[model samples]
Target: MLIGEVARHSGVSTRMLRHYDSLGLVRPTGRTVGGYRQYTTEDIRRIFHVESLRSLGLSLRQVGRALQDPAFTPSALVGDLIRQTEERLRREQELLDRLRAVEHSAPTGWQDVLRIVELLHGLNSSSAARRQQTVLTSAEEMPVSTDMLAAAVLSESDPNVAGALRWALARAGGDGIARVAAGLSSANGDIRQRAVLALAEISGDEANAVLAEALENPDAAVRRHAALAVGGRGDTAAVPVLVGMVVEGANDVDAAEVLGSLAVDATLATPIMHALAGELTAHPADPAVRIRLAQALAEMPGTIALAELRRLATDPDPAVSLIAAALAGVLEERAED
Candidate 1:
């Protein structure tokens, strides 16, 4: 076959075939009387081989080595190609994700598109400062999509960046609550924790509802955080968990404070007093537990807490009695105020 016929048959363009011949990648096997290049069956087969290698991302030089060198091993080259392809795929997937985020933002024009893209890039940046700046700067410019904030918060590992992202999410409004809530169900423990923390900062009924669910989570840390958040909102349901935290001495001080706040409601005051009294009764032998409970009891307002503190004041353990007596005196003075 002549060059044109070979090009037609192989789908390789004539110019490329000539270029291949010039590079000695594929030379014509013969020439006609007019001295035009001619290709034999062997030459056409080589062209197909070159095209085959090129399809696998082989450069022309590599293709020449692959076709001509009997010593060339494809295993290394094939492995390299696989790595390169995987890298390309990762880049492409990231691009697709950015595009989806931009689409989710419902950008009104090129400016919105660019802003969203920049924010997405910054969120994925290696620098925690850049990520934090992205969220703060973009927030000042326009409303960030909740999905973007949700994703950033879930993946954020740096303490400062995570805090800023939470603040940004809170400022971005409740739009991302569902997305953050979805993270609560993630199999990753860190992700679930992040979800609960983010939810704690979000001010909405939906966020509160999700935090309510988290209060029963099997993860003790998750449950504790959820309880604290719910208790802050004055939900009585958190009383038991807050009470438990006092007994276990885990953030017991803060838990007691929240319980005290809950006790401000007249209706909650009695139950709050009862719950602490019950803990004291259940763990009478545990003086350390009693000491924490004694402090917690003092956080409550009204005469019930004062009476409980007085009863604890005469306890047999000197340390427990000492702390209880001190708290009772403080409450007695406060009652006068």
Candidate 2:
């Protein structure tokens, strides 16, 4: 086949075939009287092979090596190609996210577009202080989109910056709840914990629903955070986790407060008291656990909690006995008042 025929037959352009010949990648085997480039069957096959490698994102140099160098293994080269392709995909996805965030902001003019872009850059800055400042000082005139704020909240590692992002998400209202909620399903425990923390700051049914869902998360930290948030919102579904938190001494004071608040409703008071009492019974030997439970019971309202507190007042451990006696007296004095 001549160059033109080869181009037409193999979908390889004549210029590219000539370039390939010049690079000694696929030289023609014979020539006509006019001295035009002529390709043998094997040469045409090599041209197809080069195109095939190119389609897999191989550079011309790599393709030449792949075709000519018998020592060149495809394994290392293919792995490298995979990594490069993944990096390209990640960059493209980030660009798409930025574009979507900009579009979601609904910029009215070039100035608004620029401001939003600037805000996005600050939010993604390597410096935690810059990210925090961007969130805290983001102009009311050009509010950052809820999606961008939620994304920032989910990925932010610095505590101060995360707090600022959460506050911004709260100010943005329930709109960012679903985006933040996506972090709850992340395999990373830190991300799931962040999602719950952000959701806790966001008010509304949607955020509350996500918090309630997170109460069942496998990560104990995630569950404790969600339980505290949802329990404060009067979601009784967090009762068990809150009780567990009190028993485990993980943020037990805050957990106890939330449990006490949940017990305000008359119907929930008994179960709340019973759950605390059950923990005390379950850990008979762990005096520290019992003391934590006793303290938590003091937060509970109604006669059930008072009775449990009074019973704990005589506990064997002097520390438990002393604290429970002090708390029971406080509860009794309050009842009289």
Candidate 3:
């Protein structure tokens, strides 16, 4: 049966069905070919269990857990959960009793009535806030946020955005990285790219296999996202991937950015030196790529970096000439050291 039929047969509103879905309560037995939920008789019975529990003042959360292990019949879980339920009921009863007390007394003035109304509204708002918080806290325990990556990616291209994203990744508390991993091959290009970047930033908790596999992604953007995310970790595990990105230049622009990020670590000199040598020796097929390559080389200091700079000095582009000279000065300082 469809959701509407389930709602009618189960005497639970479609709204409650959606809420149940959100809470991992009763899922549809299957979906129709067109994607409408098709519920089984078993599904309807589960829906009633949820409704009966709710009627008993048990939270939907309580009902969801009960459905998880129906046969276990643990007195302890029931006792603890029922006690917590009683606490909520007692709080509600206290408010009702206060309201009754207020109603039993006559309001002496318009000001008194207004004050009473304000008190009632405040109580309702507080109660609603508590309910929402409970839902959020319980949902958070599941460790999967539908928008965890988007939350990390939005709002700014720099500073505020980057700071917020870094904080989110560094502080992420979930076994739910699978959500992003699942989105890696989404039909939408942007979603795929965003997940790639997220997985990259979250590289430490992530499996090494995921990172290694991402290096082979067909999309250059995704590949770079992986490279930058790993490089951001400053983990030596990422060194090999970064080295691979250096040689895999689908274009020189992205590879240069990767090296620039690598240069943020002084210990990365060895890998950056190797990449610079490869680019200088192979000679980039694009003039712009050649320029970015020279820029990355100019940013590093060493015999390899110096030799690459000296080679670029003879390039026809004047920009390359200027950068080579700057790299020479860096090499001269190395001699003086």
Return the top candidate by lDDT.
Answer: 1
- Which should have the higher lDDT, number 1 or number 2? 1
Of 2 and 3, the candidate ranking higher by lDDT: 2
For all predicted structures, in order, the TM-scores are: 0.74, 0.91, 0.45
In model 1, the runs with Cα more than 4 Å from the true position are 1-92
lDDT (tens digit, per residue) of candidate 3 on 183-239:
566676776676676566553556345655676677666766776665555544555
Poorest lDDT segment (10 consecutive residues) of candidate 3: 142-151
How high is the lDDT of residue 291 in model 1?
98
Backbone clashes (count) for model 3? 0
Per-residue lDDT tens digits for candidate 2, residues 43-93, read: 888888998999999999999998888988999989999999999999999
Q: Clash pairs of candidate 1? A: none
lDDT of 1 by residue, 93-198 (tens): 8888898899999998999898887788789999989988888887877667888899889989998999989999998888889888888778899998998999
Clashing pairs in 2: none
**Residue 230 displacement (Å), model 2:** 1.1
Deviation in angstroms for 293 in model 3? 1.3
- Candidate 1 backbone overlaps, count: 0
